[model samples]
Structures are given as C-alpha cells and as structure tokens.
Target: MKKMFNYYSDKYLASWIIKFLDLIVVFVGFVLASLLRFNFEVAGMSLSKLLEQSLITCAVYLVIFSLSKTSDLVMRHTSFTDIHGIFKAVVFSLAILIGMDVFLYEGMDYTGVFLIPKSILIIQALLVMLGISGYRLAAKSIYATFLNSSSALKSNVLIVGADVSSLMTKSTLLNSSKHSIRVIGHVDNHPKLQGKKLDGSPVFQLDNVINSSFLKEKGIDEIIISDATLGPAQKRAVIDSALQYNIKVREVPPHEKWVNGELTENQIKPVRIEDLLGRSEIKLDSINIQNELQGKTVLVTGGAGSIGSEIVRQALFFKPKKVIALDQGETPCYELGNTLKKLPEDIAAKCEIVIADITHFRRMQQIFSKYKPDLVFHAAAYKHVPLMENNASEAVETNVFGTKNIADLALRYKVQKFVMVSTDKAINPTNVMGASKRVAEIYVQALNSQQNSTHYIVTRFGNVLGSNGSVIPLFQKQIEKGGPITITHKDITRYFMTISEACNLVLEAGSIGNGGEIFVFDMGESVKILDLAKKMIQLSGLQEGKDIDIEFVGLRPGEKLYEELLAVEENTLSTHHPKIMRAQIQPVVSDEVKVLMDRLHEKVLHGDDEGVVGGLKQLVPEYISKNSVYSRLDKKSSQAYA
Candidate 1:
C-alpha cells in the first residue's frame, strides 16, 4: 500500500493512470448528474441522440481540460499552480458548454438542458474537484500512516522555543512527510505561545512540560530548540528542562554557520557542550582592525589547534604577506596544510604550516632566523588544570621556560612585535597550569619593559569551545557511549569564546600592543559546567535521565569554581579591539630573573621535582596551590633542605 502510490514508483506511468482516472471521473460525474436530473426518462429520444449529446459534451470538456492541464495526473498534488489550472479548466469548460447550449445547439440543448439542469451541472463540477483532490490527500495520508507505524521511522520530539525559527521549523515538519520525527509539541518560555497551536501541535509552556508527569503525558521522546535569538543563559535553561524530562533535544546552528540564507536540514545539528558555554557574542571593531595586521607577516605558533587554526583562518582574509603556521602535531598540521592549499589559490600560497615545538629553544631560534617574521603569536601551552596540577614541573618547563625561550629568541632575532597567548586561569592562579602561565606572562612583560628591540605583549582569554581537550568533545563522546557524562562540579563555571572569535581578538590585540602590555579579551561571563553537560546530552538526541545520565565528580586538584580574567592589582586601558583591554599595571621584574632561570634549568635537567617546584615558587611569588597535596615544602631552600 505504501509503495504503490510513491511519487517515484513509475512516476510517468502513474501520471498517465491518474489522467485516465480523472477523465473517468469527469465522464461519470456528468452522466450520473444528467441521469438523476432527468429521472432516466427522455421523451422522443433514441439511444443515438443521447449518445451523440454525451459524446459532444465529453469531447468539449476534454479539449478544455487538455488545453489547461486539468486532467494531468502529474499535477495531482495541491499547489498554487494546480489550483490555477483547475480554475482555468473549469471556467473554459463551463463557458464552452453554456455557449453550445445557448447559441449553436439552442433547440438541441433545449432537450439536453432538461437532462443537464444548472443545479446538476454545479453538482457535477463539485464531484469532479473532490475526485481529483481526494486521491492525492488519501495517498498522503496512507504514506504518513505507514511511516508513523514503522519503528525505524518514528521519532518522538518536543520543540523548544516558540520564535520565528521554531515556527519555520514547525512549518517544515507538518508540510513534509519525509521527516521521520513526529512533533509531540513545543516547550517554550514565552507566555503568549503557551496555549497556541503551531501547525496543530500544542505549544507546551516551560512550566507545563519540564517535569516528569507532563513529559509522560506528552509522550515526548525528543526535543528541538529552534530559537537562535536566545542568550546563553536562557538557552542553558531550556536545555536543562529537557534533560530533567529525559527528552532528547536538537537545535539550529548559530548565524555564522548559516551561509547565504540557507538553513538546510543537515545544518540542524545536535547541540554540543560548547553551546552551553556563556560567552556573549563578540562585536568586531572593523575600523580599528583595518589599521592593524592588514598586510603584515603574522606567525602563529601552535597554529593547527582550535585557537591557532581559527587565527590563521581569520587572518587570511586580511591579505597578510604570510601566515606562518607552526605546530608539532602531525595530523592537525597536515589537515590544516591541505585546507590552506584549497583556499583561494592566492591565499593558499601564503599559508605555510611548519611542525615545531615551542619547548625547543634552538628550534624556535632557527625558525626565527629563517622566517624573519614581522609579528609572532606564541599560543602553545599545556593548559589542562588537573593534568597540569599533577605534573607541575612539566607545566613550568612548557609554560614558563618555553615562553622565556620564545621571548628571548624573538628579541635576539629582532622580531618587531610578539604576542603571547595567556589564559584567564593566569589571574590569581591556584593550579600549576595557571601559575605557570602567569609566570610566563610576567617573563614576557618583563622582557617587553627591559628592551626596546622587540615589542612583547600578552593577550589573555578564557576557554575556547570545541578545542582539543575541551569539555564539549568529551560530552559528545560520553553521549555516544550511552552513559553518564562526568562534570567536575554543579557550580563550576568558566568563561568561553568561540574559537574563531577568540583568535580574531588575539590578532587585534597583537596589533594594538606597543610593548610591555598584558591585554585581556573580554570573556562575556562564566557558565555553569553541569548545565552545559545536560544541554549537550539533550542536543545529542538522547534523554538525560533515561538515555543518558550526568554525574558530578568532585573538583579536581588546583581547579577553581570560577575563573578570573584579570589579576587583582591590574587595571585595564581601552585598545583597538573594544572587547580587549590592555593591562596598565607595570611589570615588576627583579634582576634575579636570569639567576633564578639558571637554577631552574639545572633542576629541570637533573629531573629534581622538589628543586624544580621550589625554584618555580621562588621565581613566581604569587603561585598558590588548591585541591592538591603537593604543598609540603616552602619557598626558602626547600630544594637544598630536602
């Protein structure tokens, strides 16, 4: 039954069959009405006369219908064009019939008029319209029934948001039988849309359908969020409601992803943990940006990762002399290299991917000598909080010593401007990663102040969504595995930015830096971790408590409940990028920096964990420990005393 009337099931043949059926309907309707009007009695009328009159009427009707495509089966579907065709066909056919009876066959139709009364003619036309329209509607109904009954095709869904985007979504859903999901209804925050019907599906308000009882009543197995106008907080709230009901959720991507006004079904992707991050939209200051890095040779270390790759992408549009991509990761480098080559051939030739580790001072020195880069963006760092907490010594080597090496090489090689990427964790740091990053900032700021040779600056931002080791990817994987997604804490919050937006600000900051400045890109606000996880689960087409579960793990070592963008003593000055502010505080660098570096180098070389820890604390006095048991020693001679 389902396969018989499918549009693709011998469409040409079906079209012909429908045309014949329509012709039969037209002939049968006219003949039946003629018989009923005359009571099957015609005085002085032979079978030949009746046959001739009926044949002439049928011929006239067919001619008008054929001219107007009213009898065409290919147009069985109800569309504006089809309606127009029906109107034209009916009007022309009726005109011909009335003309023949009144003019050419005046006396002949006097006999035929008795058989075909005006009432009977109207009745025949109505029957004909129903016969044609009924077939298509019946076919659609049958198809829908078959699709709904199939376990593989059935999808239970609840819509989130009652905005224009959601309305557009509902329109697409009810009009198309191809979509597998059965829209259970909407769950919206707006009061006006609460009791309204979106294409016949009820709009369940937030309070009406957030709990277990309402969800059970609605039979909502999934959720869809169609509102892109929602702020990060409201978006998170809607996701939480779905998660509480154990309903799967889906949503449209942000405006950035919707290119050229096309929002295809495929673009409606599942929400990820990154969507839960509460960084406000970045408003780019194009006027100030045009004055910076337009044609400069920009080198981004670790250019293959999320943040670095984004920087490279945004920088290419500026028509820079060259974007030197540096990273040690093979796969990401290759992928980025291939992607660069495929970009408009002119831009492709300017993007260069180099595999290098920032930790190796000699390697960085050689690269600087070779490239003579006008500007350098040093973004390579070991930034995982708990992991860095466990391996504080490694963190120091990479974050602190690696930064020193890069700054020194940039200065030696006469690099005009250098920008160091810093994180929010660097402010009043608790974890080793944050402390090491803070120390690195001090090292660069000190270098910037000490010399006029190289303009060294630091740019600080918070977490980037979809970056490697980011929580977004972790939640997605957990959802795929069909189990509990672990969040550090319910109240744990952190600042976030889209990877591309973060990188754009980084470039803008580098251009604004003269020397000895620490710039902070305004991360809008902090977002809760638990809420993010639940949103991710909902967006992945899984119910939170039913299909998937979220578990709260205790805070890891050296982790803070919330992250800060600036240190307590630091004040900000407006820069070229409106969102980015330059720290006005002077960097205090003791002459003992080089001496401390020498001892720290020895401790790292000999693999003395205690000496390395002690030296780091002595070098960075602001270093603090949290949720870690590695605070047994003090700053004074702890290495030698051990």
Candidate 2:
C-alpha cells in the first residue's frame, strides 16, 4: 500500500522503485494469467513450478522497462506519452517472451518444455497493460484528491462557468503547485451542467450565487470567471455580487494574452472598467466603407492622437491608395510609423507619416497641393477643457483656424468626404474647448453645399475609455500609487465608448453620410466617477478608506456635472445603423460662418483670448460657460441679446 501511494509526493517517484513495482505487477499478473488460461486448475500449476517462470518473467519485464525508461515519468502526472512508454515496454517484453516460448532445444531434448507457456504469455500481456494503466490513473486521481483535501494553506476558488474554458482554467490552476489553489466548485446557469459533478465539485447555478451561502460554507477565498462567451453585463453582475460578498474575483485572461501562447496562474487578472462597458460589437458596413475609401488617398490630421491613430489603422483595411498620417508631434509621428510597419508590408508602405501642423495654412496647403487627398479625417484639436479655459486663444487657433484650413483645402481640392471628429461636449458648449469645436463644427457643416464637390461630415461621440489622459487610466495610475483616486465630483457622470468602437462608427458614419450631417453615436449609459473610482479600488484588491482612499476634488474650471449628447433644440433621426443618428439641427451658411470665423481668427492672430471668447459666444448663441471665468461672457452676450 505504501508502494502504491508513495507516488503522491512533491517530486517524482524514483525510477528504481518504479521498476521494482512494475516487476512486482508483472510477476503477480503471470500467476493470475496462468489460473485464467488453465481454467483455475491450480493442481497442475503448483507453486514450485510457477516460482521459476514468474522470476524469469519479472527479469524480462524489468530489462524492458529499464531500456524504455518507462518508469522515468511521474506516475501522478501520467500523460499519453508516458502511456506510450509503457506500450513500447510491453511489446518489447512480449517479443522476448514469444521467442523463449517457441525456442526448441533439440540437443537437450526439451522441445515440449515451454517456458511461461504461449497461452499464459498472451493472457499476461493483456492483464499487464490494464494493470499498469489502472495503477497510474488511480495514482493521478488520488494525488489530485490528496492535494485538494490535505492542504490547509491552499486557497479555495470557485469557478464561474462549467464550460470547456472553465475546465482548462481549473486544470491550469490546480496543476500549478506553487499557487496551491483548490477549485471548490463551478457556478453556471446552463440547465445541462447543473447538479453535475466536476472534479468531485458541484456545478451550481449562478443565479444569486453570492446569496446562496455556498461560498461561506466552503470558505471560498476567490471566484474565477473563465467563460469567454459570457456577456459584459453578466460578467459585471457576477463581479459586483462577488465584491459585495467580499470575495475577490478574477477573470481568466483571453487566450491571445497568454504568455508564450500558454495559460499560467499569474495571467488571470481582475476585470477592468473597460471590460464592463457592455458595448455591443459594432458591425461595420465594410463594403460601403471600401467603396468610399478604396484606391482613395486619405489624410488623417492628428494621426498620432487616440482617435486619429485608430482611424488610420482601420482605414488601411479598406485598401486605400495612400494614407497620410499628418501630425505636429515628432515623437508620436515616429512611433506611429513604427506601429504601421508591423502591418503587412503593402499596407505599411502605403502609409506616410508627415510632421506638419494643421494650424499652419502654408504647411497644410503644401500637403493638400502635393497629395490631393480624396478624403480627410480631422481629429486634431485642443480637447482638455481646463487647459483650454486658461488658453482660449490657443484653442481657437487650432480648433477654429486649423479646421477652416482643412475644410477650405478639402473643398478646393475636391475631396469626396471630409469627416471631422467632434466630441459630445460640442453640443450646448460650456467650455472654451467645446465652444471652439462647436465653432469648427459650424464652419465645416456650413462649407457643405448642394453644388459643392466636397461633402463635409462630422462624427461626434462621448469619452473613449482608453484614450490618452482618460479617467480610467488616471484612476489606474492613482490606484497603483497606493493613494487617493481623485474625482472632480461624486455626482459627476460621463458617457464612454471603447477607442476601437468609436473609430469603427466614425468610419461607418463617414461612409453613409452625404453632406452637412452631425452624426452622434449611441454612447451607452453614463457612469458615475465616484462609483468608477470605488470599483477600481476593489479591482486592485484594495479596500476603500483602508488600503486606498477616494478624494472628491471640486469641479475644475469649465467642467460640467453632466454631459449632453445633443443640444436643447436638437434631436436625432435614426440612420440605417442602430448606433448612429443624424442630428436634426439648424445649419449655418458659409457666408455667415465665414464672417464669425474671420473675427475669431483675427482675435487669435492678435492674441486677444477675451475677444476670441466673445466672438465664440456670438457664433454659438447657446454657448453657456460653467464654473469658468468665461461665464462672464455668457452674461455679456445675454445682456446684448436682451
């Protein structure tokens, strides 16, 4: 019994001990085979007669097992390769046994004396294979059970699904001896899997799993979700319930993120805010987008920025003739080049990164003159609200003057479509950044005409989760620093989308637009910043106010408590796509928009920020400043209106 159970150790059983055990099994198997072959006629097979043949059989198998190194593998971790080793040993031993059984010693007159008779050798071979495999399998199963029940230090983790993925995750965690984790059970709602036993653990329903008191009973320290098909909403629900129960929850990393293309225990991590966005996958009108961009030379201003870079990446898939990644930042432009080079050589070669400023008319004109782009995506602007509030003139220079240059050049060069990347903040603007973008939106929307060859389109969206300087990254860094995660206000809320999803809709909306359309994306439900901060803390495996803290910093200049996607007088009409809509708002004419842009441009040229703010109010009458010095301009404009 000790020989049988000694295989359940931290290290592998000794090869010599393994050989001794295998020979013992071979000797016993031959005796059992002799009884079965002779119909249990033990009188003919006396112990004295069997002893000599059993020793010879054990010696032959011992030699075969040594030569094949069949005992070199860990019995408790036996795989098919180890089983194959046993098969080779069995066949080689059988070859020697058959030779001895058939050999006729004519000189000694022993032709009838068969050593370990032919019938017994055949029966023993069948018995040996079954016994060897059964021994290893029993060892493996017992070792697993021993590890599950014997270790008081091991953590008990409950798996969140009963699928193939969950099985793999369970095997990975259980096999990692360093982690010392025992999977308590699986939680899933599939009707077929319910009440089923996986690795001797129950597969229970996920409905009210946290409330079931099963976790407390089992002393489950963590919950691991490994189901790939589980929707984001379902995942968030599980995570939320687990957090409330003080049960740490982690998700198995996607297969692609596995290190060296193999899953490991360390790779599993807590689900991030990005994972819970629950954003539906955006299905693109790829054929329509291809028809619009195929063989067309495209220009993406601010191509190094978040949204601009993503558009460039997606647009290349449509087989554009050439894509010009125009941005002023030399470093980002170089980085973008390196990124583009990772694509197929053909697509990478079709891309060119130009270091140029959109605000400089001569530079942009030179680009427009040389490439004569058929389509342009303008993503460059001063987007930081607080920073722009302090530097209103600079925002006007880039957002206003830069936009005018791109629109005029697109019109002059007869570009098919010009898509301007706008923000939801542009609607009913309350900040200099939003007002500047609104001014640009007015300019671009005004430039589109019935007879004009160029069609100006605007795609407006809310915050993208992983964009540079976005809230999610900010909270992550703060949590990493082990400090207070700062929020402008507890009640403040914002809409969010993934960077890829936002850019996909941009491409989709650009393909389907005619001209003079401000397209708004369906940015799903808003998220409260305070709640977002708390979740980030929990995901970091830290308790709020104990391991970390959430600091409510007052709202910054020009920051609003709530974000709006459409203005008070404006509503959206659905397009062919469910997520995209055309804003039904009054469009300004070119002549009128040109006059206000000229005044804003003159103020920008004179470095008169106040005059620029005043001009912006005149351009967008609904522009109301909030918690900003520019709020005085709202009053001034309102008085003038009165």
Candidate 3:
C-alpha cells in the first residue's frame, strides 16, 4: 500500500486517459442536471435529443480543457493553480454553450435545433465544477497519505518555528521524495499560534518539558530547528528538554548557506556544543585591522596551531603583501599548505611556509631579516598545566625564551607591530605554564617602555573551544570509549571563546595597540565543567549514571578551580571595540627586565629547574604554585623572607 503511492511507484495516467475521464465527467454532469431539471420524469424527455445534447456538451468541455491544457498536470501533484485552470475552462465552456443557446432560441422554439434548455446547461456547469474539483483533491490527498505512511519516513519531527519559513521548511522536508523524515507539527511560543493548526498539525507550546506520555502521544522522536529568530538560550533549553527524552535534535543551515537557493538533507547538521555557548557573533574592528595589515607582510609564529592557523586564514582576506607561516611542526605546515592550495591562485601565492623554532634567536632573526615582516603574531607556547608543572624549565624555554627571541628580533628588524598571544592563566599565575607566560608578558611590556620603533602588543584571552587537548574533546573521547568522563573538580569553571572569534579579536587588538598594552578579550560567561559533562552525556543519548559514569578526580598539579582574566592590581581602560580592553599595569624599566631575563636564561643554560622557576616567581610576585613539587619553592621563599 505504501509503495503504491510513494516516489518509487509514482506513476500517472496517460493524458488521453485523463481527457477521456474528464469528458465522462462532463457527460455525466449534463445527464444528472437534465434528470434533476425534468424531476426524474424520463418518459417526458426526448431520449435521442438528450443523448445528442450531452455529446455536444462533452465536446464543448473537452475543447476548452484541451485548449487550456489542464489535463496535462499530474493529479497527485495538483495545486491551486491547476484547480483554477479547470474552473476557468468550465466557465469558458459554459459561456460558449450560452452563446449557442442564445443564437438558437428560434430553433428551440421550433424544437428542432439545440434541443437542450438553458436552465439545464447552467446546472451542468455547477455540477462540472464540483466533479472536477472533488476527484483531483481526492487523488492529491491519497498520494499524501501514501507518502506519510511509507516505511522510508522513520521519524516524527517538529519544526522549530510557526512562520512562513517554517511552513516552507515543512513543505520542503515532506514534499521532497528523497527525504525520510516526517514533520509532525510546529513548535512555537507565540501565544497567537497557540491552539492553532499549521497545515493539519497542531502547534505545541515551546517551553513545556517533554514527558514520556507526551512523547508517546505526539510520536515525536526528532525535531529540526528552522527558526532564525530563536536565540541561543532558547535553543539550549529546547535541546536539553529533547535530550531528556532521548529525542534527536537537528538544525537547519541558514538560508544563505543553502545550496543553489534550495535546502538539501546533507545541509541539515547536528547540533554542536559550540552553539550552546549562547554568545553572539563579535563585531570585529575590521577597519582598524584592514588599515594595519593591508599591503604589509605579516608573520605568524605558531601559524599551524588552532589560533595561529585561523589568524592566517582570516588575514588573507585583507590582501596583505605576503604571509609567512613559520612553525616548527613539519606535518602541520604541510597540511596547512595543502589546504591553502584550495584558495584562489593569487591568494595562495601570498602565503610562504617556513619551519623554524622561535627559541633560536638567530633562526628567527634570519627569517625576519629576509622577509622583513611589517607585523608579527607570536602564538607558540606550551599550554598544558600538569605537564608544565613537572617541566618548568621546558615551559620557560618555549613560552618565555621563545617569546623574548621573537620580540628582540622584531625590534632588530624594525617590524611595525609584534602581537603575542597570551592566556588568561597569566593573570594570577598558579602553574609553571602561567608563570612563564606572565614573565614573557612582563618582558615584552618592559621592552615596549624603552622602544619607540616597534610597538609590542599582548592579546590575552581564555581557552578556545576545541583547541588541542581541550576539555570538550577529552570528554568526547571518553564518551566514545563508553566509560566514565573524568573532570578535575565538580565546581571547576573556565571561560571559553570560539577559536575564530578569539583570533579575530587578536587582530583587532593588534590593530588598535600602539605599544606596551595588554588587551583582554571579553570571554562572556564561564561555563561549569560539571554541567558541561552532563550535557555531553545527554547529547550522546545516554544517562550519566545509568549508561556512563562521571568521575570527579581531584585537581591536577598546578590546576586552579577558577580562571581570572585580570589580576587584582591591574585595571582595564576601554578601547574603541567593546570586546577588547587595554590593561593598565605598573611599568618595569627596560634595564631591570633585561637583568631578570639574563639571569633566567643563565639558569636555563645550567638546566636548573628550581632556579628557573624561582626567577619566574620573583619577576611576577603574584605567582603562587599549587598542588605541585614547585610549591616547596614558594614555601622556602616565604620562610627565608620571614
């Protein structure tokens, strides 16, 4: 039964057969009208005359319909436009019959030519309209039933909005022969749409929680969000409610992303954790960035890493003279080269790949002297907390010494701007990684104080979503392995920004900075790791305790429960861009910073882990070690001072 009307079995009658059926309707309508006009007294009627007149009526209807080509339309797909064509054909045929009747009134008086009465012809027109409209509607409804009942339609769904786009989305989803999903109804919070019907389905309340009974009653196993006006908070609420019932949720791509102005099944994507962050798109200070980067050669040090790579990609849009992607990772640089090959030929030619370690001052200096980059973005660093706690010397080697190497060479080569990417952990340092970054920041700021040739800028932001070794990917792997998801602490919270947004703001900060300024990005709200774990479990269609367990391990070495964007002693001054802020810090003279770095480098040369970490703490007095072997150093320093 399902196959008979589905797309595979979509067959329509031949045009000749449909024309014959239409003529039969016309003949039957005329006979029925004659019978009704004569009060069913067939004996008083002239049977031979009635037969001739019915044939004439059929011929007239057929000519008009054939001329209008109404029968060529598929009955199963008949629309309002098709029905209107039939109505026009019927009225036109009626008018022609009326004209014949008027001219042959004398013949009717003689009871010889045109024997049918005008009253009978009028009634026949009404009957023809009803008959033509009824069967086409019946065919269309039957085909719809077959499609809805097909085995291909496996899931019942609710569209997210009750608007014109939602209605169009419903029709597109259901009407497409290739789609396997069925739209059960629409969901909206508009009070005006409550208790109302869209198409033949009822609009359900949006905020109501989905219970088992309601799920069974509505047969809702999925929902497709198509509403552009629905905010992130609203989307998160719906997603949470749907996941409670194990109902799958998907979202439609924005209309601008539609393929060739039409929606495709491949374009409807699954909801991602990033969308739940509820932050709007940042309005980048593009004018400032463009004016700064245009026609200038730029260099990004960690150019293959997440933040660095995004910077390279977005920078190409500003039509720079050239971009040098300098990274030590051979494989990542190669892969980035392949990806860049997919860009326009002219743009692809603008990027130059180089493999060099930033810790080597001569290698960096050589590159800077050759390319003479007008602007430089220094992003490479060791960011992991526990690993850096154990390898304090190595952290200082890359994050501090590497940064100083780049900054010193930038000054030598007369680079226009040097932007260093720093993390929020640098604000109130608890880990060796954070301490090293803070020391690097201090060195750059101090260098900026003494220099007027090259401006040194520091852009500080929090963790970026889906960066290497981030929590979200960690939980995803644990979930895939079907076991407990490990978190440091239940109350631990951290700020997050999407990688693209953070890098764009970095460019904005680089554009607006003159010299020696630390720009802090607004990281919106901090999300609780405990809540994030639960949401991930639910999103995977599993219960936390029932299907998989969530284990709260104690905090790792040098890890903190909360991350801060600003130190207590530091305050921020507003920038032209609302999302970026310039931090006001007490300045250190160039001589003092140079002395401290020289001592730190000497300790690094002697491979003294303790001495290197001790020097970093002395530089940033706020630095305090936690849950690590380095905490002993803090104890010794306090005891000696006391």
Judging by TM-score against the true structure, name the best candidate. Answer: 2
Top candidate (lDDT): 3
TM-score of each: 0.70, 0.81, 0.75
| Model 2 worst lDDT window (10 residues) | 104-113
What lDDT tens digits, residue by residue, belong to model 3 across residues 195-248? 899988789878753423565577788888989898877888778767767877
lDDT of 1: 0.73
Q: How far is candidate 2 from the true structure (C-alpha RMSD, Å)?
A: 6.1
**Residues forming the 10-long window of minimal summed lDDT in candidate 3:** 207-216
Question: Candidate 2 local accuracy as lDDT?
Answer: 0.85
> For every candidate structure, what is the RMSD over all alpha carbons to the true structure, in angstroms?
8.6, 6.1, 8.6
lDDT comparing candidate 3 with the true structure? 0.85
lDDT by residue (tens digit), candidate 2, 1-642: 444433546578788887788887898899999899889998777787788788888888888888888888777666555777798789889889888765644334464435567788888888888888889878877777666555558888999988767876886777555666877899888889888998678898888585567677778889998987777777887877777767888889876787655577788887787876656678888999999999999999999989889999999989999999999998888889889988999888888889999889999999999999999999998799999999999999999889989989998889999999999999888899999999888888777854568999999999998998899998899999998888989899999999999999999999999999999999989998888888778777889999998888899988999999999899999999999999998857778777777777888888988888888888888888999987877666433421
Model 1 per-residue lDDT tens digits across residues 1-642: 555545353444355565677677777777666666677666634556555556665677677777776655443233434655676676677666666655644655455422444655666677667676676556645544555554365667777767666765654444344666788787776777767887678887676565447766767676677866667676776666666766666687764676454355666666666655645566766655555666778788878988888888877887778889999899999989877776899878888888988889888888888888877888878889888777767878888888888888888878888888889888887777887787788778778778898998888988888789988888878888897899878899978788877887887787667888888888876778887776666566566788888898888988879888777787888865578887777546646676777787787777676676677677766666667765665434544522
- In model 1, which runs have C-alpha deviations exceeding 4 angstroms? 1-142, 145-247, 253-267, 389-393, 488-491, 540-557, 573-578, 584-586, 627-629, 635-642
Query: Candidate 2 has which clashing residue pairs, if any?
Result: none
lDDT of 1 at 445: 72
Candidate models: Cα lDDT each: 0.73, 0.85, 0.85
Tell me how many residue pairs clash in candidate 1.
1
